[model samples]
Target: MNKFAALCLILCAAPANAHPHIFINAGLVFVVDADNRLTHVQVTWEYDELYSLLVTEDMGIDADYDGVLSEADTARLTGFDMQWIEGYNGDLVGTLAGQNLTLSAPTAPTATLTEGKIVTTHLRAVSGAPQINGTLSFLPYDGTYYTAYDVTLPVLVQGGNGCEVTVDTPDIKGALSMTKAEIGALPEDFDMEAAGLGDIGRRFATDVRVTCAAL
Candidate 1:
């Protein structure tokens, strides 16, 4: 199922001069094993009320028309984990020791409607997770900027000791403005691949880094 399209039903609402039709408040919790190797990332995405309303109407969440999410409502929406499609990496990119970490299918996925908002949580296993030594960083963003992820929670380092985590919200205002200008200047028939602006979304991401002292 195309979760992105499902979440974004009102495509025409997107501004013509910019992207992000929907807004999400995201939180991340880093999971590590006893050996201090990164194992998984627990992600919580709280969607805006408007998109949540769309989900309830379109995804059959409020099946009973009760205006409340029940166990059955959440059960029906289980396994709604967004999948990588058409070169889209679900807007989350992780790296360990400067090497990209491959992400597996999300596990323990769940969804609920609370206070007129849709909240989803899942665990993304870190395939080939490196032993934590210096840094583990992640960049979350949508390539087309269809959804803006605002990560508000502090990165939690769990099941590991002597580790320090810091979040760097890089100043991307200049770079992103430049990228938008470049994209706007492109000819209608120009190929983005030829222009090499394909990962332009990364310029607007918040960088989360984890560093630990010697174990």
Candidate 2:
């Protein structure tokens, strides 16, 4: 099956109690134009050691098993994750003033092996170049909760004056309580396939908010 179809099956089969198999430390750099318009965002994903090992092994790279990549290996690994399937939002959601912002396809992909982990980055252009006045929010999450993302790295604003960036973590206790309540409300015979639990990750997502001084 194709990537999109496979993702559909994974989402359908995922239960409310499903835990993430892959973990990522994510970072974002908001790029603003001189006119104070939000133009692009550079996203970074650092994969965990286990996942990094798996990827290297699967690709038959890193022959020395030293957890370091050669130049050729880095070249081959670049854009490996950029082959995104249609209908996938790259696990990134952005909103400004309560309106969803359209993001262009990933570009300028780069990959490297650092300290036994895989680090990758790509840029996504904001389609309309919206003015940066009010608050802008972003969340990185996998709908099925199969891959967990944490804003553990630097969240920066580049080329924008008087802009402040902050990370607001979700209330884990409250989110867990709500999830339990929803699962408990389901009837004994309720079909798990119809549970619509794919969005459980959003409840625990870390919010990345940006606010710019009135411009």
**Best candidate (score: TM-score):** 2
lDDT of 2 at 136: 95
Task: Name the regions of candidate 1 deviating beyond 4 angstroms.
Answer: 1-19, 63-67, 83-88
Question: Clashes in model 2: which pairs?
Answer: none
lDDT of candidate 1 over 6-84, digit per residue (tens): 2223222233344457888888888887778888898888889998888788877786766677777778776665654
Candidate 1, run of 10 with poorest lDDT:
3-12
* Local distance difference test, candidate 1: 0.72
TM-score of each: 0.83, 0.86
Candidates in order: C-alpha RMSD to true structure: 4.7, 4.3
Q: Model 2: runs farther than 4 Å from truth?
A: 1-19, 187-196
